[model samples]
Target: MTEHATRHTPPEGPPGDGDVLLVTDLSRRFGDLIAVDGVSFRVGRGETYGLLGPNGAGKTTTISMVAGLIEADAGTVTVKGHRMGPARVEPKRHIGLVPQELAIYPELTARENLTFFGRLQGMSGTTLASRVEDVLDVIGLSDRAKDPTKEFSGGMKRRLNIGIGLLHEPELLILDEPTVGVDPQSRNSILESVESLSTAGMAVLYTTHYMEEAERLCDRIGIIDSGLLQAEGTRDELIRLTGDVDHIRLDGSGDTVAAEAALLALPAVEQVDRERHTLHLAVHDAPTAIAEIVTEATSAGMRLNDVQITRPNLESVFLRLTGKALRD
Candidate 1:
């Protein structure tokens, strides 16, 4: 895959302007299963944070608690410094959630749906009408505002789902897999919309299993697995967890065991493993280590088919920490 430019950049220091939300020791359970265990993090105003992990990793559950969809079994959830619970309407009004499932009505027009949600938040009259139009224009669906949502494409429906959340002008917006099951064009449009919103000073909590999306959009990411937070940092910071190792993939034929032993014996080699006919090696330096491995393999009568050296990335760090591939 060809590389693309990234928009995410790590902050120089702690996010200090104003914390929009703070979660402390968040925990949740369902019978014998611990869905979320002591997951704690903070989101600053206008900052875009991400929760990334494999399927069934409790990312959804943690966000659900934060959105007040479900009560946590333990720990505290505060939004804009106000504790979250069923009793706090003021805090709830400041947050908006766009769930993975489309929450728009099929029979209602896009404009009608926005008006309904806006009214529920106690907005009405010319103010509500103006806000609805503003959101439609921002989502690039102003021309379709009067059309019934049943006739809209999958992408259009997804955009309306996001528009409904923005009607309230929320202090924080939580998106749970908002781009799933959409076309590439729609996905790109949605990402651009999110970027524009963040630039307008909106705090966003994005949850997705897609690494490239997180790498492109998030300022910092927190990776979770089976209810436990495994790592939390910017993309570069997390990649640094792999140390100075550079990944090298080679395909060749020799005594696999002997080849692994020879590679490990090299001074710069940190770790080596074999799968099928391929050898995966992690080394401190790319040029010198590649030279040593190639020379040793040639001496062992092995014919290398292909060799590629790659820098440490989020995927490699995930594998090193979890002992399994992210897709596994």
Candidate 2:
């Protein structure tokens, strides 16, 4: 786990006026197992915050508490200045959750599904009709709005489910891996929709184990593992915690021993590992170090076939903090 001091301290009273969701020292237990322990974070308007972790990482449980699906054993969730809970109508009204599982009725058309959910939210007449049309267009389902959901692919259905959540025009949108099991096109569409929503100033709480997704979608990320928030920050901020190094791969034919010796002499090169024809160098600043690295390798009698620099990314940060790959 990352150091605790770096974590944000919970505010003295309610969420700040600018914050949409404030989770403080949230803890949960299922019998003897502690699913979420003292996990806390805040989401601001127009900001997308991501919770990333492996399976059984308490991500769902944490979101469940935040969504008021289940009461937390301890801690508080403040949404738009109101405490959150299953029975808390006002706060719940501000939340829109797009669950991992499809919640739309397959028999209903896309527009019909949005309308039905809107009605359930107490909307009607032109207001409901206009919102439904807007959601269909946002989800890119306007052309097929009249088609029965049963005729839709898994991706289309997923998009419809998202449209249903969006229908209410909630201030806070919680998406629990909304793209899982969808086709590539649908996934991209969903991601694009999320980007637009954020740009339009909706607060989004997203949970996913996909490193690329977190990097691309989230304004900030909270890495959860074994129920605890292991780390939290922007992608670059977290990567800096892993000693801020870059990896360079040299693939070619030559005496590996001389190449390793030469790279070790460079000020930026910190470590070198040889794997057959490849020499992997852990160094600082690839862009500034590459030319020198290439020249030094050739001078040491290493014929470079290909030189590739792998920058530190969320995947590397995940490995450094959690002691496991993002997928693992």
Candidate 3:
């Protein structure tokens, strides 16, 4: 079981400024193996909360339970004060889920797909038509509204997937790795769409293995590993939990093995790794240690090609706590 610092009781009414999604002691099991073990966190109104972990870290299982697609073995999921279970229609109404897969129909036009989902959500007539138009504008596909989705680009299809989620304008939006296989241009478009959605006051629960996305889009993040929530907080708070360390990378030719050993012997250096021509070092005080590192490289007969000092961020924090890369 995972331990939480504090526990919150389910509120009586709509989650007043406190939280939109409150998950407490959530755990799930598959026969003999526990998938999600005691995860807990809260996402406030209009806030973006990121759930980050490596593959098989239980992120998908946890999200499946939250979406009411699977029943939890133990614990509670409260969405805007309503408890979520197999037959909870009200809570489900408040959530719009955009899964990792393409949920839009390839044969239908963008507008048609929106209308189809909008009507399924109980929309109709003028309201449904207006919503479809509005969603097309929001997704930047108004020009392509009448074009068949099969003709759309990968990014456009992804945007349409998100449009399906917004057809009902649910109070909370859950996006699961929406940018997986798209090109850089398409990825940026999808990210911009997410930012706009949050600005429109929709609480978002996002799951991604990409550290940059989590850092850019999340107001707070929960890091889960091995079925446990290792830490949960804002980026700064999570980084602080990993202690103050700066990551430095040096790319050079010649004697990388000797350079790696010399850097590791430094008093400020915590770890050293060498990959062919590149050397990665984690140090206590980077600003003061840069000169020492260069000196050590010179003394070790390394022909330096490039040097970079990167400040610690979510990736570093994740590496510190999980002891594995996020992509792993």
Candidate 4:
């Protein structure tokens, strides 16, 4: 199929409106290793913002500091214009965190877990009970609230983990790989729940290595690597970082190896990958570059069976920035 034409627009300057959460020059260290180095970004109210990076990219360390689980060696984190720290207890009320690890007790029922957390947050009696039930319904676990968490499926356990965070209805919900290890059905359910929360005006700081999840869920995403904010914008904005390149998929025969190398030598070619009979290429300009590729293949006695060129996607953008696939 013919690739759709897309215009790449540059990222605009920071938003003029007040940000709900802001971090400036955030840094963390583990001895000589700089786990989080000078990361900075802002999340707007009612915005679904994503922090995307591979493992050990400092995503967790940054969020941990923002959530007050760890103190930053330098930098400041502000929530609703109030700075974060031990003394900022009021700001703590404005933030909720769903960590990568399940924080609930396996021995406790889902309701018990939620209630326990609610009480620790200063809730009690009927107020705590009602809130637990409310979040149970929000997480689609109202019917299973009485079941011990250990007996639940992986997806159910994940939902309950999220429920524990939402019990207090904090203004900003930070989710760290909430869908990891869950079944596809469960992952979809959790994603839908997150979307619903954003629709209800809850600002979310979502951290994940899953490109598709970020593309589907985030209003904007911040790409971090090696302790720095490499890029920040919507998926389209990030894709623009890869210049004007568009992607083309080709299936052909007759020494695919030579064809792959030859395509990479073409002017305006940015990236090329050959897997079996399928070849994926990113080029500076699709129309001209694809034509040249087809001509070269034909000259080399290759039979081209299928060709598909697509506009640059988040995956392409990610590959360009990180020099590695998202899964890698």
**TM-score for each of the candidates:** 0.77, 0.85, 0.77, 0.78
Write down the lDDT of every candidate, Cα atoms only: 0.83, 0.89, 0.86, 0.83
Which candidate's TM-score is highest? Answer: 2
Give lDDT tens digits, candidate 1, residues 109-184: 9999999999999999999999999999988889999999999999999999999988898989999999999999
The C-alpha RMSD of each candidate to the native structure, in angstroms, is 7.5, 3.3, 6.1, 7.5
Q: In model 3, where do residues sit more than 4 Å from their true spots? A: 1-16, 247-309
Clashing pairs in 4: none
Lowest-scoring 10 consecutive residues by lDDT in candidate 4?
1-10
Q: Which stretches of candidate 1 lie over 4 Å from their true place?
A: 1-17, 247-309
Candidates in descending lDDT order = 2, 3, 4, 1
Across 92-199, the per-residue lDDT of candidate 3 in tens digits comes to 888998998998899999998999888778889999999888889988899999899999988899989998998899888999888889899989988888888888
| Model 2, span 1-328: residue lDDT tens | 5563345354456567779999999999999999998888999999999999888899999999999999999999999989999888889889999998999888888888898889988899999999999888878799999999999989889988898988988999999989889888889989999999999999999999888899999999998888888878898777776677889999999887898999999999999999998999998888899999999999999998998898998887878777789888
Candidate 1 local accuracy as lDDT? 0.83
Best by lDDT: 2
